[model samples]
Target chain A: MAQSNGTDVRLMKGNEALAEAALRAGMQAYFGYPITPQSEVMEYLTMHAPEHPGVVILQAESELAAINMVYGAAGAGARVMISSSSPGISLMQEGLSYMTSAQLPALVVNVQRGGPGLGTIQPSQGDYFQAVKGGGHGDYRLIVLAPASVQEMVDFVFDAFRLTEKYRNPAMILADGALGQMMEKVALPPVGSLPRSAAPWATVGKPATRERNIVTSLFIQPERMEQINLQLQAKYRTLEKEEVRCEQLQMEDADFALVAFGLTSRICQKAMELARQKGIRVGLIRPITLYPFPSAVIRKAAGQVEAFVTVEMNAGQMVEDVRLAVDGTRPVHFTGRMGGMIPTPEEILAKIEAVVAEPSLQHA
Target chain B: MKEPDVIEGMEVVYRKPQTLTATPMHYCPGCSHGVVHKILMEVVDEMGIQDKTVGVAPVGCSVFAYDYMNVDMQEAAHGRASAVATGIRRVLPDTYVFAYQGDGDLAAIGTGETVHTVNRGENILMVFINNGIYGMTGGQMAPTSLLGMKTSTSPYGREAAVNGYPLRITELLAQLPGAYYVTRQSVHTTAAVRKCKKAIEASFRYQTEKRGTCFIEVVANCPSGWKMTPNEANDWLEKNMFPYYPIGDIKAPKQ
Candidate 1:
């Protein structure tokens, strides 16, 4: 096994980059099932696990089993992760609910494809609402990171683990089929950079020195369950306040804005340039953390921009959040392609032009 | 004093193991879940692995097995205990891990996880408590419910046409190569209790050898769920359940 002297660079697929980055970030175990657009993640880990001793990678029978395995490993104080595509992720919602209720920290990578039911193998942001708005039962939030490129995919693996462990909650890297399949240069984190932290609550067997550890989400009493829900809500509030992150691209004197994320955000950046060439004065706001959403930034921009156009590869999922942030002050228009369709810059630019060219907006 | 009379000459016949916590279990009187919990903890206590063992509790009557078992424990979702044990065992390979599940949890809802975990040869003990009914949910029919068993769901007694035949999951699991040790034991009799204790101890020992999955099916009784008194439930189990379940080892490792 060759040692990593910090600079381990490779042109890798987005899913592969995430897997390598997870291993480099000192992930202790990975349990996953095969799902299209993300199968390479486990494949890469299974092939490279020999190079990284002390890491356990197993292909589980199903997504439900994979997530529960993650739940168990995380409860046992292991840095663990699981990855799957959209439909498989849907199957994991029950386990995710259990994980969040137990307050176990683990990483879930959703390489999203089109959805509703076995939608398509192509990339889609249809799961944005699912990721941000409690896809599972119960009141819980997963710290969601949207990576637009393979490099961001590599970088956010460490960030997701850090956030999940720091807050003692589950975190998700919401990638799409496009970003998962695309190849780009990524600088993997140095080996052994992220050491396992001490988990006082982990069920690692109770020595006499400490009280026995019990990991569970079951609260038989209604008052006790309410108290746990209150605690989780409080944590979510802190996440919203402190963890909101986004890229404000060229908003310095803009009259209009384009709100997008992940792969669609890259397309929006191109559309912004196209709109700018037409004297539209459009800027792009790319949300990196979807859960602790960059609402404050979008609200601030709402005061300056005449209108906002949310571009997505789904049927206007994130547009709802953008509208909520804009708060009816400005018309937040939406243009999207659904069922595994990718929105072109020209199509998004047309929507932006129509929103700006509205007689009401022209008068304002 | 009355307490001091012949105290020194008395030999201890029975005592609650230290591994069984002082927390009184919530199981109904004569429910065999408590009995299984007692002997399982006894194994952990006698083996001196209470600190080295981790238990995964299922969602049925023993959902709070963590409360009564004084080891590091985790409560899993309804049927996912075996999968949860797999995660724990894989992460801490040397830790003695076991998943305690019930009839519905193991044979029905969690059958996939149970089968796959065994098939993968996950080095853990799976303690399945087959009460032939869903005890926690008010006496619903379980997959292992006898063909003519009556329950809340099976009001007219289970019929193969409507309810399907009982599943012999323990025997089915024994056929898998990953199942290194598979056995069926009961706790209705003093002799049966001893055999069940031995089975649990053997499963824990097999875990140390890294052989494969060790499974113990305790043909337990649910007095409250069956609407019977403790003695009646025990008698019923002996007469009716044993004929079908047949307490004995189904598979064992070669010498």
Candidate 2:
């Protein structure tokens, strides 16, 4: 409900807004390493965080150290966060997996750049599979959220912290280099108190009244560990039902629909406008939650639309999810740019037009 | 020396520190982790900081420290316990925090974390256990393994040309301006155990003084890993380990 106006909004990069909003959302600590594009998150926080009381900002020695520091802070019952980019995030997968098994709530930001391994600093959604499909080694999922704008980047910091507490699982704001670097006017969340019950399993000290709280991911006993895994899976099931977030535009009698998210979705929004002007009857379904992924809406769209086209900054990573959502009800087509390339609106528009022309491209 | 008079119907000593849990430790004979864990717990209990103490366990044989130490603990991945301890100490500033790590975990794989944590002056105690071999992972040659030492990984006695030299990590860390106390002691003998315990308590005390990181490296012996009996390991350690990782303080805070 908070909106940016002349008084409340100031044009800022997505990374800056994310940092500011996290502080406002009661983040007690920020631990991170400097990495390309994403480094601005820590930079902005370091510059502004001293103004906020009780906030601890630390520049970690490495991404490995940063994420583990987040693990420690999260275990200590602090509202903690960490930010990094692709190769850096790769370095953090072990720590992330530890947090997952521990079931600690942490807000992590990945201003992703190109990488199979340290590919480029340019924006790319190559990490979509990594974010939603458990980049860390575990039968777990990071509640992945894709923010398409500076506003959502700001807004989702609050959303991410809340969802993390609600499920007690790590939540990632999967933005790419463009969203992190682009400047826009954004309204930040007001300072609010996190509910005490958020981290019931946190390792607060053993006082006279409360028992000692131990936070760990190591479950050596096989049977009990399996039970914990099942319990985590159950919570994930609840999240899939409850946390599927998406935005639909111009679906009224649309014969063709475009599916994308984050930066690609914003590009698709422009492509949709261009397609509508050219009478293509194209619409958009912007998946706000990449993990739970708005599959129900896509299923609904599949009933009405003749075909679906997915645009992404990666080489057809998310198209697989769209296919599963449509489930052979209709045809699906994918077009993408990889290795740090961002596809333009005209390029996306041409792809959508081509999908509409070829009837046999349905199963693709 | 005479034993203190005992009072009837009163337990003079708790026997074990209250901070040590009832669960039995899985450390092998002469591994020194059990002795280190016991002494650390004793220090925590004696300091009356049991309720506010948090321990970060490293990924090695002692990763299961959480099961034995009564205090709240978080298990860090291999070589990141210092960073993890730093985070916890920052959040719970008033809480006494320490990281328990092995030579391979600290001196080798975690060298960066161990050095930088000391360099950053984080107010946490770092308990480094330098037993010449990697005990948990089948007695591999550790960074602190002696120049002529032979183990599973180095079946042919370690040669300086092939394996480099044993690392004097405490000496390396002593040069850091942020390190308030960098001491090397062992737990192989009763006298050494007492000195090691004193060093640990001193390091924990410095956390409250708001001084920089206190690194206490305990040069211990691993009998099973070294293919020696407990007494033989201690004798071998005295003959070989001490010459390389000599006892006594490498650096100390200003008096």
Residue range A167-269, candidate 1, lDDT tens digits: 9999999999999999887777778777667899999888989889999999989999999999999999999999988999999989989999999989998
**Deviation from native of the Cα of residue B92 in model 2, angstroms:** 1.3
- The 10-residue segment of model 2 chain A with minimum total lDDT is A1-10
Q: Best by TM-score, which number?
A: 1
DockQ of each: 0.89, 0.74
Docking class of 2: medium
- Model 1: per-residue Cα lDDT over B1-255, one tens digit each: 113324578866667887888898899999898889999999999899978999999998899998999999999998999999999999999999999999999999999999999998899999999989999999999999999899999989999999899999999999999999999999988899999999999999999999999999999899998999999999999888889898899998886
What is the DockQ (computed on Cα atoms) for candidate 1? Answer: 0.89
Candidate 2, residues B148-242, lDDT tens digits: the string is 78889899888999999999999999999899999999998999999999999999888999889999999888888988899998898888888
Model 1 CAPRI rating: high
Query: Model 2 Cα displacement at B74 (Å)?
Result: 0.8
Model 1 pairs in collision: none
Clash totals in order? 0, 0
Candidate 2 local Cα displacement, residue B59, angstroms: 1.1
Model 1 RMSD to the real structure?
2.1
